[model samples]
Target chain A: MSSITSSKKHPLFWVLLLIITVVTLFPIYWISVTSLKSPVEVISSRPTMLPQAPTLENYVSVVKSGFFRNMFNSLLVAVSATLLSLTLSTLASYALVRHNFPYRGNSLFLVWVLVVKILPPVVLAIPLYSVFIKMGLLNSRLGLIFVYQVYTLPYCIWMIFGFLKALPETFEEAAMIDGAGRFYILTRIVLPLARTGIIATSIFSVIAAWDEFLFALLFIRTPSLQTLPLVIVNYIGEYETLWGELMGIGLLTTLPVLFFSSYVYKYYTQGFSVSLK
Target chain B: MTQNKYQKSCFFYLILLPAVLVMLWLTIYPVLNVFTLSFFKYNYLSDEKVFVGLGNYIKLLKENLFMEAFRNTLVFSVLATAGEVILGIALALLFYGHFRGKKSFMIIAIFPMMVSSMVICAVWKTLYHYDIGLINFLLRETGAQPVGWLIDQSKALFSVVIIDVWQWTPFAFIMMQAAMGSIPEEIFEAAQIDGASYMKTVFSITMPILSDQIMLLIMLRTIDTFKLFGKVYALTQGGPGNSTETLSYYIYREGFSYFNLGKASTASIFVLLVVAGISFIYIGKILKKD
Candidate 1:
């Protein structure tokens, strides 16, 4: 009786695990499979579970449709914004962590940062539209990069602040005693120790900017300047969707993020854990 | 020495000044600008601006489309957050102990969350297609009638919610699993030795210990789901008669599509108040912990 019960429980566990694994991953599998199918097979009444004659035609066509230009736009904006936000946030968070400001300024600043993080992006976008127009930043890559700071800056500050707070002050204090200047100590001692956190924060920031759509849609008018997401949406037109090409662009756009995310999977999970605390 | 100390403080502020200035321009000034814009009759295209104190707000309140959008946003937020958190706890429990292929399985499990949401939505959009979709194809295989997943008004919002739950459950699971790892194994071992059933141990021992983490997860997911725009825009475009229209999407259409900055600003203010109320509760809890 005991053996039978144990045997019954084991298979149930495996079955449940298999169910979840399939449910969680099936869309990704379907996307890849659909992307490989020819346009005729993609929209057929009887959808092929596997492309009978798998081809790279969808990818070719999508690329021919100026996919690379959009991808380049996305890459440029994401990278530039990530670098800018990371630099600003690292300096600010370091100051917040290491120095005392008057009137409980550190805590007040942190509270404000948290509010900015929580506020919906659309709230800011409404006003920012006019602001950008006045500044002549409309329809420019530089404008998009600057606007993205609204999302990335507060996040980088908080994540980096957590990491800086966790580091022991002894190392920095000793460096100060040795007459090392503050900038020298910061460059030599603090940054290296917080390298993991900084890398993790930057990767997440890049992903956020890369995926940003609402701002890009509103700001960029020129077909040449639009980002990957805008192009992906264009594939799903009001009249007809180019499913094969849509999936092709979708998979292509995701590959870079997937590669980077897997590389930092450990830190990604750790970042969430840190945020929880 | 005091002069040197003062100089060092000045250096700190100097390094911090740039971020402070950008944030002030980006967040503070825009927020105030949005508030002032909400009171006007403004149109970007024609460059018309007239002060209509609270007229935009009153119009939005009476607008059925706006009301429907509000209701849909509430429903979507509640359902998506609840689904993600619950499924997350279950996944965490299922994968609690060590097993063969655990690392690979965990990595695969989290892949959905890492991918761009647009890509995820595009994939699901194909799968949710009424006639040609894989989901409908399967239903026919089992001799079940096909359901309109995204096209049906009753099912559109729920379809969007399912995609959100699919993508984000891993996030909640990762968080829950991390918190679970912190629990000493000895406690579970003690419970087992005391003849506690698995269900009993989970409910009594594990849950009480995990309540705080669970609360934090709910707040985080709530704040995120409240800002649901990209998914709706990509999938339904809040279609099939406004079933999936969210506040963010509503604002996007009003502000961008119609160029009605006045209406958009008013809707944005409504979203801001609700979000502020929610975040205040969350911040209050997080601050108390500190």
Candidate 2:
């Protein structure tokens, strides 16, 4: 992969790249500008390329209207889901990679997990909603956390399994030769070495749980219990035509994932490429 | 050694037990529940339950709304997946040559995919508004009649597809770029030395080599685009006479808004079958390759 580097250049390449970048990034730029604009400019007939009177009024309103509470709800669900999924899947992937189960090798188990990952959320949502209602989990944060495992756990197993598969088994073997227990070998030898993979896996889990809309929309009814995506939807309805504040909340919803994606930029790409292979 | 091996196997089952049970409980139990629920006439609001025995499926097959939702979902998935893959290949090809600031350009280009789909729809919703939208404003400046991008029945579905293409094409581009990057430089250099033109290299060399990756990406995008909900919810809510009503939205409304569990479960099973079919092809291909 590293052997290929084409130095061929043309003015056409530069122009095309410029156009593509502009087209791709323009919406984000426009939304940021709208968030900073006064309401008068937001609904103006002629769209301004830049904000005329840049103000924090929209962002201020968003915060003053208890945006942080919803933010906390989103964070709590996403974090809890990530932690639980990571621990469970780490153990699961370890077992699959290192040991045999009844009548099959680990590939079947891996494929089973992948199937869960690929299943449509709506297919799960209906049954889960009814089940949650019966169990008194409706509109509860704990309910959302449990349901998010349907989304987070499978992917966690898939990626972490790949990481563990690629890792040389010698370290674990040496520890085993010294009579280290499986749990000790895992915690003392495996987890630290697989730190980057764990982070990459968790980022996806957090993002999936955080940005989930369908389950959050169906499962949570109370406004205070809603996540960020639900709050953004509610803002769309309550502040109908209040484009400025709506865009403000929209930006708030997007910025964290953007920062997280960029923070793990290297591993994010690597992890995806590895999983594809 | 035998005792140790047996002990190790015990440890394996012990370690695997929690995730296995949880996944099975979450996945298998709910799937089975939905499957069985499809056979009964159940409504969440009225606490009514009765045996339907293919009644919901028969009714849905005759329901125009369900048919329309199915048709819209199929159309959206095909168009959006094709558009994203084609545009992604084009974008990747355009930026194949090394240049200054390429890394930053890629970072900026992939920003759309990193943002939430709901947020992207919100941004596009403003741009697609009838009168004051920036798109219409530009049209007016050009002396063209303004288009109702999302408000017209014939245009609403396509408009939603455009937003999807905008958001997800970057995924295809990133995957293809990585695949293209892995090809050794000598292959291209060899083709160039053999007097092959750039177009020939792309068509004859680059494409054939990248075909597997392209196929994988197409399958992934196809599966994802089939679950079209967030954009429709945030943008049009399947309005303009239900032109943008996808299967996911239809299922959501039936299950949540009306509390018709039977019909919703029926539709959900239809979706599950289609998705399982698509994924089976993908998984079969991967397993065969290995």
The residue-level lDDT of candidate 1 at A132 comes to: 96
lDDT of 2 at B273: 86
Isolated chain A TM-score, each model: 0.92, 0.92
Error of 1 at A71 (Å): 1.7
Once superposed on the true structure, which residue ranges of model 2 sit more than 4 Å away at CA?
A: A1-8, A263-265, A268-277
Give a tens-digit lDDT track for model 1, residues A167-239: 9999999999999999998889999999988988888889889989889988999999999988877776542
DockQ (C-alpha based) per candidate is 0.54, 0.55
**Model 2 lDDT per residue over B1-290, tens place:** 89987888999998888998888778888889999999999998998999989999999999999999999999999999999999989888877757788777777777888898778878898899897899999999999999999999999999988999999888788777778877888898988788788788889999999998888888888888988898888888899898999999998999989999988999999988888888997888866754
Question: Per-residue CA lDDT of candidate 2, range A1-277, in tens?
Answer: 2112467666666787778888998999988999999999989999999998899999999899888998999999999988999999999999988887877757777777777767778888877876789999999999999888888888898788877877899998898789887899999899999887788788878887888898899889888898988887776666667899989988998998898655444553553443431
TM-score of each: 0.96, 0.96
